[model samples]
Target: MSDDDLAATLATEAGRLLLDVRREFADASVDDRKAAGDQRSHDFLMAALAAERPDDAVLSEEGADDPVRLSSRRVWIVDPLDGTREFSEPGRDDWAVHVALWQDGELVAGAVALPAQGVTLATPTVATPPAAPQHPRIVVSRTRPPDIAM
Candidate 1:
C-alpha cells in the first residue's frame, strides 16, 4: 500500500481503538478513561506500524521519543488521542486521532479520524477546503475556550 493509504489506515484503526476503549471504560473515572484510551490507541498504532512498516521509525504521544527517527528515511508521527478531555466527556465529539508520515523532511501523508462522528479525513482523499466566508471565523472548543478569545 502507498504511504498515504498506510497513514489513513493507521488513523482509522487508532480511532476505532479509542472508541472501544471509551466504551469499555465508560464507568471509570475521567482521568482513568482518558489514560486508558491514550495508551491503548498508542499501543495499537505503534504495534501495527512496526508490523506493517518495519523499516520506518515512529514518534507517538504515548511513546518515548526515539532520536533514531531524526536519521530515518521515513517517520510516522502520531497523536493517539488528540483531545483526551473531550474523548472522556459524556457527549463530546471533537476529539481526533492523527497519523502523519514525514518522509525525507516533508509531510508526505496524513489522516485525522473523528471516531465519535464516524469520519476519517485522509490525505489524497481529503475534502476540498470550503469557500472562504465574507467574515473571518475562528473556531475553538466549547469546553476549553482560549482565554485570549474573551
Candidate 2:
C-alpha cells in the first residue's frame, strides 16, 4: 500500500483496538484502563509498521525514543492513543489515534481517528472544514485552556 493509505489503515485499525480495550477494561480503575489502552494500541501499531515497512523507522508515544530514527530517511510518528484521560472517562468521545509519516524533509502523510465518534480523517484526500457558524466558538481543554483561547 502507499504511504498515505498505510497511515490511514494503521490509524483506523489502532482505533478499533483501543475501543476493544476500553470495553474489556470497562470495570478497571482509571489508571489501569489508561495503561491498557496505551500499551495495547502501541503494540499493535508498532508491529504493523514493522511488518508493513520493515526499513522505515518509527517514533511512538508509548515506546522508548530510538535515536535510530534521526538518521532514517522515512519515519512513522504515531500516538497510538492520543487522549488517555478522555479515553478512560466514560461517555467521552474526544480521544483519538494519530499516525503520521515524515520522509526526507516533510510530512508526506497523516491520519487521525476518532474511534468513539466513528470518524477517521486522512490525507491525500484533503478535508474541507465545515463552514463556520455566524457565532464562532473555540473548543479548548476544560482543565488547561490555552491563553489564546481564554
Candidate 3:
C-alpha cells in the first residue's frame, strides 16, 4: 500500500479505536488513564503495523521497547493516539492522532492527525520537517501547559 493508503487505513482504524476507547479509557481511574491510554495506543499501533509493515519491527511508546530501533533499517515508533486528556474529556484541543516512522534512528516520514480540527497534517509537503521547523508552534499539553509558553 502507498503512504497515503497506509495513512488512510490507520486513520480509519484510529477512528474505531477512539470510539472503542471512549467509554473504556474515560471510565478508568485517573491513575489508570496513562497506562490504559498507552495500552490502547500500543494495540492500535500493533494492529496497524501488522496489517501494513508486518515485516518491519515496531518500537512504540506503550510496547516494544526494542533498542534495536536505534539500529534497525526501518522501525515504526507510533503513539497511536496522543492527548489522552482530551480523549477522555469531551471537548479539548489536546487530543490528536500520531504515527511516527523512523529509519536508522532518523525520522523518514510521519503524520499527525487531529480529528477534532479535522486536520490530518502530513509531513514535508504539509510543512518543514519538525526537527528544524522554521516557525515552531510548540506543542503544549492541555493538562500541563509549559511554564515558558502558552
Clash number for each model: 0, 0, 0
Q: What is the overall TM-score of model 1 with all chains considered together?
A: 0.82
| Model 1 per-residue lDDT tens digits across residues 90-142 | 88999999999888987888999999999999887535689999987685778
* lDDT agreement with native, every candidate: 0.90, 0.93, 0.66
The TM-scores, one per candidate, come to: 0.82, 0.83, 0.65
> Each candidate's root-mean-square deviation in Å?
7.6, 7.6, 8.3
**Clashing residue pairs in candidate 3, if any?**
none
Pick by TM-score: which candidate is best?
2
User: Would you give me the overall lDDT of model 2?
Assistant: 0.93
Question: Residues 41-147, candidate 3, lDDT per residue (tens digit)?
Answer: 56877887888787777766567487766666887766766777666665564676677666666666677777656666655433544576678778668888787
Candidate 2, pairs of clashing residues? none
On lDDT, the leading prediction is 2
> What's model 2's lDDT at 10?
93
RMSD of 1: 7.6
| TM-score, model 2 to reference | 0.83
